[model samples]
Target: MLEKLIDDFKLQPPHAVLLALEPLRAISDYVAGIVGPAEALPRGDGHPVIVFPGLALSGAATADLRVRLQQLGYELYDWEQGVNNWPDADFDEWLQRLGAHLQRIHARHGRSVSLIGWSLGGIYARELAKKYPKLVRQVITLATPFTDTGDSTHAGWILTLLNGAAYAVDEALLKRLSVDPPVPSASIYSQTDGVVAWQGCQGKETRCHRNIEVNRVSHMGMVHHPDVLRVVADLLVEPC
Candidate 1:
C-alpha cells in the first residue's frame, strides 16, 4: 500500500501537488482570518497559535517555525509541553491536558486559534478540533499518516503497540474532521517525505478538505520549507 504512495510521490510533480492543494489552503486560511481574532497578538498572542511538532522533532525544528511566523507578523503560542512523542500516553488524559491548554489560550486571546500540527500532531489537532471546535479556527497536518491500514509503513516501535490496529484508522474520526465544501483544513505532504507514506497523507475528497504535496522538502524539513512557510503565511495573514 505504501509502495504506491511513495512511488506516486516520486513520480508526481510537486509543483502540481502544490497547485492542487493551494485552493483549499487559501480558503481555510481566509475563513480563519475572518473568524479569528484580528489583533497582532503579543508574543504568543494570548490566543497563541498552537503548533505540534513532527516525529523525533527537536525544539530547533519548530524553532524556525515560531520565528518564521513571528517574522511573517503573527503571534504563536508555545506548546509549553513540547515534543509530544507517541508515548504509551493515556488518550483521555492527554486530551484533557491539551484541552485545558486550549481553554487557557482562548481565555487569554479571546479569539479562535489555528492548529499547526506535524505528523502525529496532525492527528492530535483533529481530535482537539472535534473536542473544541469553537476554539479551533483551522487545522494543518504535515505529512501525517492519517490513513494507513497497513503495517508495512510503520516503524518497529509502532508495530509493537499496534501490530494489527490497522483498522483503527477510524473513518468516523476522519469524517468528523473532514473540512470539505464547509470545513477548513489542510494536509501538507511532500514527494520526498521520508517518513509516513505520502498516500497516507491525502484526503479522498477535494472540496472542503485537501491534501497538498510540495517538492524537495523532506518530511522533517516540510515543517520549515520556504514554500510551506509561504503557504502558511498566506493562510495566517488573511483577513481572519
Candidate 2:
C-alpha cells in the first residue's frame, strides 16, 4: 500500500525558494484583492454555506472569505470546531461532533449546505459530503492534496509528529479521499503552490467536477486570492 501511495502520488513538493516566498505572495494577493476591479457575480440565493479552515487554523483564518460570501447574500457558517488539529486521539469523536453540527444546520435551514474547505479542511469537506450527500449542495476545495498521502506535502513532517507511527498510509482512506464527492464539486489549485504538490490537488474531471487552476497563487494564499475567490463565487452561484 505504501508503495502504491508512493507510485501514484509521489509528486515533489514545491521548490524551497517558492516556499520561502509564500508569505510575500500571500501579501501580494491581499493587495490585489483590495485594488482589483470588482467582478460581476451572481447573487447567492441565501443557502447556508460553511467554510472550514486548514490544519491547525481556526475559523478566524477564513474571515475575509466568509465576509465576501456573506456579502453575496449567502448565509455563512463557521466550522465552529476551533482549531483544526485532525488525527488526534479523539479524531473519531471530533468527526462525530462535526457530523452532528452538520445535521443541526441542515435541520435548521431545511436545505442542503454548501461546503468550502481550504487545505486539509478541504479533505474534511469532501469526506463529509460523501458521508451525507443528501445534506450537501456542493463542495469547493482550495489547494487541498486529497489525492496524495502526506508524501507530497511540506506538512508531511507535521502529520508525522502528530500521528507518530499511526501516520502510516491507510489505503482505504486514501482510496476514498481520492474520489470526488457525490455532489457538484470543484478543486481550485495552483502550479505555484508552495506547500503541497499541485498534481495531487486535482481529481478526474467530469460534468459535475472541475479542476480549476490559478497562476502564481501560494498554498496559503488560496483562501484570499482574488482569482480563487472568483472561481469559488462562480461555482457557488451555479445552478444545482
Candidate 3:
C-alpha cells in the first residue's frame, strides 16, 4: 500500500499539490468567518458520539481519540460499514445508514448526536449533517477534504472509478444539505501530512468553527496525537 501511494504521488504530484491548496483555502475562509456567534456545543447531556476515519483508515486506528472522548462522557459509535470506503452510491445513501445509527443513539439518550470524522470520515460526517440535520447536533472533521474528497493518494482506484463515472462535486447537493452557520465545530489539521496534502486539510467558510494548525504529525498520527486528543476533549467540553 505504501509503495502504491508513493507511485500515485509521483504520478500526480500536481494533483496532490492542488488538492493540498484546496483545504488550506477552505480553512482560511472558515477562519475568516469567525468573529460571529457559535452554536451551542453539546454538553454531556447523553448524546452518542461517532468517530469516522480517513480514507483507507478506520475508527480502530483512531482508538486513542475514541477512548479519550469516552472518558469525556460521550459514547463513540462505529460505522460497521468499515473505514471510509467512499460508498458506491450517493453520499446521502451512506447518510441514511448513518442516520439510523444516530436516531438509535438519540432514542436512548434523548439528545442529538455529534459527529467527529477524520479525513474522509470528516467529509462523511459533514455530508451526513446535510441530509439529516435533526439527527446531528454538530459536526467536526479532522483533516478531511470537503472540496473534492479533496485529496487522493492511496484511493487511486476509487478516484479513477469516480471520475470515469462522471463523479462531480455536487455543490447544489451540498448546499441543499447545509446546516446553520458555526455548527459548533473544530477542524484540526497538520503540516507534515504525507498522505493527503496538509493544504487539503485546512477547511472553508463556516461560523463558530475553529481551525487549528499543528505541526510535525503525519496524516496517520493526527488520528491519535496527544494534541489531537486534547482538541477533542475541549471540543466536547461544555461551554463556559
Off by over 4 Å in 2: 1-9, 89-93, 161-167
Candidate 1 vs 2: which has more lDDT: 2
The estimated TM-scores of all candidates read 0.69, 0.91, 0.69
The global C-alpha lDDT for each of the candidates, from Candidate 1 onward, is 0.63, 0.86, 0.61
Highest-scoring model, lDDT? 2
Q: Which ten residues in a row have the lowest lDDT in candidate 3?
A: 33-42
List of clashing residue pairs for candidate 2: none
- Residue-level lDDT of model 2, residues 153-197, one tens digit each, is 887666667656445556886787899988999999999998998
RMSD of each: 9.5, 3.0, 10.5
- Best by TM-score, which number? 2
Instruction: Give the clashing pairs for model 3.
Output: 24-199, 26-203, 26-204, 27-203, 117-122, 182-207
Model 2 worst lDDT run, 10 consecutive residues: 160-169
lDDT tens readout by residue for model 1, 134-198: 88877777777666433323443444445444324345644553433233677888765554567
Sorted by lDDT (best first), the order is 2, 1, 3
lDDT of 3 by residue, 136-239 (tens): 77777777544433223435555556456633455675454333223566678776555565554555555666578765555556655555555666666655
